[model samples]
Target chain A: MSENNNYTFVIKPKRTLWEIDLKEIWRYRDLLFLLVKRDFISVYKQTILGPVWFFIQPLLITITFTIIFGQVAKISTGGAPEILFYLTGITFWNYFSSCLTSTSNTFVSNASVFGKVYFPRLIVPLSVIISNLMKLGIQLLLLLMVWVYYIINSDAVHPQIELLLMPFYLLVFALMGLGFGLIFSALTTKYRDLTFLIAFGVQLLMYASAVIFPASVVPADKQWILFLNPLVSLMEAIKYSFLGQGIFSWFYLAYSTIFTAIILVIGVLVFNKVEKGFIDTV
Target chain B: MGNIVIKAENISKQYRLGTIGTKTLANDFKRWLYTMQGKEDPFLKIGDTNDRSQKGSSEYVWALKDINFDIEQGEVIGIIGKNGAGKSTLLKILSRVTAPTTGQITVNGRMASLLEVGTGFHPELSGRENVFLNGAIMGMTKTEIRKKFDEIVDFSGVERYIDTPVKRYSSGMYVRLAFAVAAHLEPEILIVDEVLAVGDAEFQKKCLGKMKDVSGQGRTVLFVSHNMGAIQSLCSRSIYLKHGTIQQTGETDKIINYYLSHELKTEDELNLKVNKDIPACVTQVRLLNGEDQKTKAYLSGETLRFAFNIDCQAQGNYQLGIGIASALDVNIFSEVSELMELNNGTFEIDYQNIQVKLAPGNYALTFNLLYNGKSIQYCEKVINFEVLEINRMGETYSLSKGAGFLITQGKFTIN
Candidate 1:
């Protein structure tokens, strides 16, 4: 490699939809892995509960949802145990929300680091997504415990073959969240007001995505509107595959997957272009 | 000579000069419109001159302009300039933290930049963790970092607190750890920008030694610093920048001489005028040779006479002085009229300039008119003269040492 080396590395005019040189990213994989590890360890290092906060967060949300929607409002869990149903929703929802929120603040949060070194800007957000996957894995284990208990005690529920599709759905959710997060992160580098608005927007999006309530109960008149929300379809598919009691349309699920892939492509394009000069504007 | 590892061709960076958000949006929109029209950016033409420190009509200034340079493999180059002289801007461009507004840069190998100390260090992460994080940010592989992790920890001397969060460590420790990580990482091309100024004297010495080692290993290094002593000692070649352009580039000694003689003088004089008042009621003055006792240029390490004839209305117990200041406006040496007790009977006071140990450069003189305890009048730039480099018989005395103000010889021993 050293002998045949040409001195110059040309940056050709980038006319493609996205100009990601995956080769460069692959070369920095160690840095990416280290950064991800740092993110995971540093989050709870100083806290009293440490990694327990990961479980505590979903546990607390499940309790609150059980009180407000399950008991008082008489919201149905589609014949699945309320604890199991809500924990499943909370598990997936938390991962998506964490990925989106963390990745959205990628540029602002890493500005100090970015200002000082010459690393690919993509590494920071990519690390955010990777680290949040660890959090998602922990929450999934908690949901699995609830799921196993409900299956043993109750006669109305049994795990379905659709449960095998859970990983596919999670992958879609990760890609969608990462795509939107990168877009928002790139935009927030210049217009910081978007960062302030994202928290409230994600909260509002939760109610729309059937995290606490089943998508089948959203009313037949508004069913198409619910179907239009890609996350709604993802959530419904995850629930139906595991609990066998919620709506699952292969057509809608496929549409959601395709939508996420498209969004990811567009996100990478915008992010690559914006990152080149974002330091100056930021 | 190896291939050129880095090539920068006519690169330029433009920055808006006021409050942040307002102009960026307008300029971004204008750039978008121009892109739609398939033409160059319109605001690029309307930018003011490339001087950041000066007040100008337009809010946008080019931080760098038409900067073109090439770096060969195994070359250690120093970049010297005053603050706001676009030195950092050039480094930022080379590091790819930001893109240039015009032109392109080509590089063959992976480049690592230590532009600021503790750049990627997370306050919440322990020193051990931050080392890996910072190393990664500088583009080191995991195996590479693991291989040198112990060496880095020992070099930083923060081993006791390696597992403790960096936020709990002192700032000096943090910088030491950060610099250790940066220096130990085996990048093909290393870019360091003034990060060595963070630590104490011993650490600074260690950093300089490490820099020399890096250069000796046949790696290309681009160092930016205001410390001429370090620059002179480490770099084989140097580029002197002024007003966003390359003023001179070549051997470190020659470029340093040119920078000190021409560019350093004007900035020094301007800065000196800012802090101190010129001596009072004194006309033009100059330094002269002792035999002639007339205004004449002197050489480094030569004894000469500083002659000043002040025109006065009524002669009192007035004090006259002459001082030589550095480019940063630090007074290196000064002599007062009271020391020689030259009274006002229309007399000439010629102080025998001793040691004349200043480096080859230009120096300014200020003549003062003082009555009793107050300064009645003062005139700066009373005279300006150059210190030419003298070549003795078969030997040359280089004046690059003695960094601070005056050149002195001293020895140190570590027990």
Candidate 2:
């Protein structure tokens, strides 16, 4: 007979998939912030430029893409400057890719800490998202400086009203990254074969996401296939609002929103099921 | 006394006993299929007990099986067991690091576990930042760590290195700082597992003192340790586990006695081959009778004899110490012989005609060979023997096992 009536929490064999325990995650909010700080500082601790790498990384990638895709390949940027066109795509794509790659290693990388202590396991991935957001902010400032240069110098550049959707774009990117990362992380713990795929899968996904070229370049008949990628519209939308190029359709953005929502829900359910016993498998 | 702060009902954990890979994926699919058809998990019905030495036929083993116990608030309970006996498994379940397979544990208040000293200390971070980071990882708030920052630094005695990166600190300093942060945590229930095994002796003493203060404040403590002395002194009650089940749960000393006698192999004679590589070593130890014949069992109140043969590679002054300890490794009596100058050779030192008033139970003999004042070679439980029932006048009576190690006859004249 159980006599204690004032128990705080009871641990069970299996919890409902939807019981995400938002309140428990809220209680560990301080830990979440601390871990975010750790991730930002530790990565650039010994490097000479430190956080400046955030800016230099996207700038370098933008220049390289412009040289390769704009000069050699002769891909049209839809009248936007080659540098600006590629930088816009690289900045947003970098954040999403980094979030996906880092968060996918959650269970494997944190197996040591996770084994010894119990906290909201979601904090690891959540911290990654927040920390990468800070990096994205820095990279956006770089984008802003370049955008101002092209705006003042050239009459062909047009800034659209849809530029106000920056926050919404960032939210969708974060959710997509977190969702895919959680699902992959859960499976990676039990089956390590997924780890090999994740390294190159993000690379292969970038071409389909319209990062280096405008989505309009795709032939009209095959455009649907490129639009099927959830990130394609979001990528094209960011470029369209900034450079006044690429297709921006309400129907495509809605598809992305709905797809991201589905992925995130399944992500949380699978993540909740795995976090309880991931230590054993990992 | 405090309405049972923690209660476990039918706690059991089953683990598959092979590499987890594609093989387990097939099993997972099978289990899923069974669940969809509204049938019980078939693998749950067949699992052997977790006995590491004996190879079992089944692929699944129960790491902990039907473990049910209620821990009251402020009670310091020690869990003692041999390696792979499910001690860590139980601690993991209690700390919520892992889930049990078929049981639920209910706790009334906040719980913190120090399964390790430094769970998440970053080498790149300074001591000051790590204190905050490690504190946060252990479930402490930023405000809480700030309030206790100065005290934690002082306790660790590494104030000068507070801003220096921890990677540069010595290993001892790291452990000291790690334990210092953990000691300041005030939770309703604290689960510690062999963390005190780290740090220097003085630091270990400080950790023990801090733990005493925690339990003194009416917060429960569940401690798992291999150090029997610490367990005996800190906890009044203990649980002894063997092969995935609780073998006994009672007083700490009695449980320790049972563990030592049953877990350790019992022998009356120890024969060791002399290795010429070592300068000096204990060769052999034996328990003898009045006729100088080797024996293991003795009646209470009889004279005990011991022989220790030692090999000395070089000539030096050697002192031998002979000790008698109870089954719990508690020293009942000991004698250190006068120092004697000896040549390089093999010699036997005999402790003969020693009066034995030990109670009826298992016991051990310890040998210490010292060069000058420092011990060159030491062996514990070199020879284990038993003290049979006491014989008084014409009758023989078995003394209660828990009645102390010494046996005495007293005059009873009631007025």
Candidate 3:
């Protein structure tokens, strides 16, 4: 009995501020995959269109932006076809928006399951991000097909070496979305007023994220204000890489990465502190 | 003895009472500031015990307080308490569903809690999918679930609907499948909280048997239930909780007996103070032992005595009745005195040495007075008392509810 020096775990009143417990999340990796599968299958179970609905949403939104902003408003697509430009922006923005919105509802949406059992609470938000990434994969295939058509006939479209950095752009979007979502999820458990604000906030953030209009269209004087969003540079970078015709600054990309890193750290810390006792408050 | 698998020290949980949202952020800010300054939470100073019936004066109340216990491996410990006694809270903390406000718990080995069944069962997902999903949520890996898939299905008895979405299945089938997945969860330490209260009696028995098997396999279990019979049948040791604190902890029988007699608020004497001016009234009723001493509890199949004082201003062909009723409000049995004439005076009536031969449970005593079958001065549920599980022979005889209260000695003949 004296050899029981190393207990499996010790539960305490307070954990260190930086203790995120990544290994615990790794242990619950199966649950994360199951939840992601649930999210994917449950949503389109009864629908006739099914997975096709995933394409319809981004395509419809892209067309709407093309007509309303590209054609009617005569907004320049930065030398790329209006459809290709808006579709690229929407595909990436959809991933981040859905990730942010869904992940932000982590505590409120999963209170029932979380209240009854114990798992790494981080798994819920992480699963949301992964599932949204899958959705983005499907939508990106749609964007690639459109790019192929434009590349065959149009001379304005340019595929460059920067296009290889697509993964980096996606990494920034996921981290930023997850970070903000975690902070909001933790706060919303107690002050549910944040739930209503999230819906309205996500919509307003899209207009500022350069999803509809190209970053070049923004006056240079106020372009610095737009870059502060951290998403603006990533959006421009994605368009510049695919079409080879928009602003893609390595410095701004680094800025967004650093910003995402800091937010992710703070977000995880807040979430860890709240997840322990949110059951009582929620 | 095996090594201690779980050790809790001074574990307490405090919850804010009333409307939590009103000024909740301000309270959080205040608590944060206090902690930043290296001081105690100012709000924690003033709070009441977790008694849900009375309105508390302070906004914060300690749902659990200073709970300390240790469980060695392979020990099945039952937590017995009334509603609002923090049994659920303690289980929640142990399960890691929630953290305690003060103090710490050291746990060695994998722990799983059945605080509820079908916790993450998706309605749109098919039963097979839900089995894997729910299993994973309970801390089983995909491979582990796959290994136990056939056994889980066979145990649930819902093999026909395994491919069907759970939302379309009947409520019973849903519960059965849910409990089936939960049963297959083989964690080193199990925390269960009244999950057997669901499903039918047969299903509850199956769950109990499964739990017994788990405990028999040398795994520690912490069980919380209001059913004393189930607790007695499964747990070797028990902890009795009352008002967020441990009242007693020891052998299951002793803790259960203490909980029934003391915590249940049994009454040995009842003062009706019936008006002396009434035609016939029961003024006082007292339960007595064989020695004519006041007692609130009795063993099964024991002789019981009762003494009552009656004030009758006018009586003609009057009848006196004593009725015993179970906790479920069912009338178990009744005995009545023969019709007789009585003059106006205060008289003492003693129904002594009556064979109880009753089952173990809480029961109420009903007294009645009637004149010429008019049913005058009838009182119901005057006093409540408990019958211990011990029988006349001093052997522990476990009696379940609805097993028939009257114990009989039937003559046996064999060919």
Top-scoring candidate (TM-score): 2
DockQ score of each predicted structure, in the order shown:
0.41, 0.62, 0.56
CAPRI-wise, candidate 1 is acceptable
Q: Over all chains combined, what TM-score does candidate 3 have? A: 0.84
**Model 3: per-residue Cα lDDT over B197-308, one tens digit each:** 6789888888889999999999999999987778877999999999899999999877876676666567899887777555888788899877778998777767777888
TM-score of chain A of each: 0.94, 0.97, 0.96
TM-score of chain B of each: 0.72, 0.85, 0.73
Q: List TM-scores for all candidates, in order.
A: 0.82, 0.92, 0.84
Model 1 earns a TM-score of 0.82
Q: What does the lDDT read for residue A120 in candidate 2?
A: 89
Write the residue-wise lDDT of candidate 2 on A1-282 in tens digits: 335443388888788878888888888899999999888888998899998999898889888888888999998888899999989999999999999999998999999999999998999999999999999999999999999999999877788999999899999999999999999999999989999999999999998899988888889999999999999999999998998888998899999999999999998899999988888888
Clashing pairs in 2: none
Q: Mind giving the per-residue lDDT tens digits that candidate 2 earns over B118-140?
A: 78999998899899999999999
How does residue A106 of candidate 3 score in lDDT?
Answer: 95
Sort by lDDT, best first.
Answer: 3, 2, 1
Ranking, DockQ, top scorer first: 2, 3, 1
DockQ of 2: 0.62
Please give, for residues A1-282, the per-residue lDDT of candidate 3 as tens digits: 434433278778777898877888888899999999999999999899999999999999988998999889998777789999889989999999999999998999999999999999999999999999999999989999999999998998998899999898998999999999999999999889999999999999999998888888888998888899899999999988899977889888999999999999999999999999999888
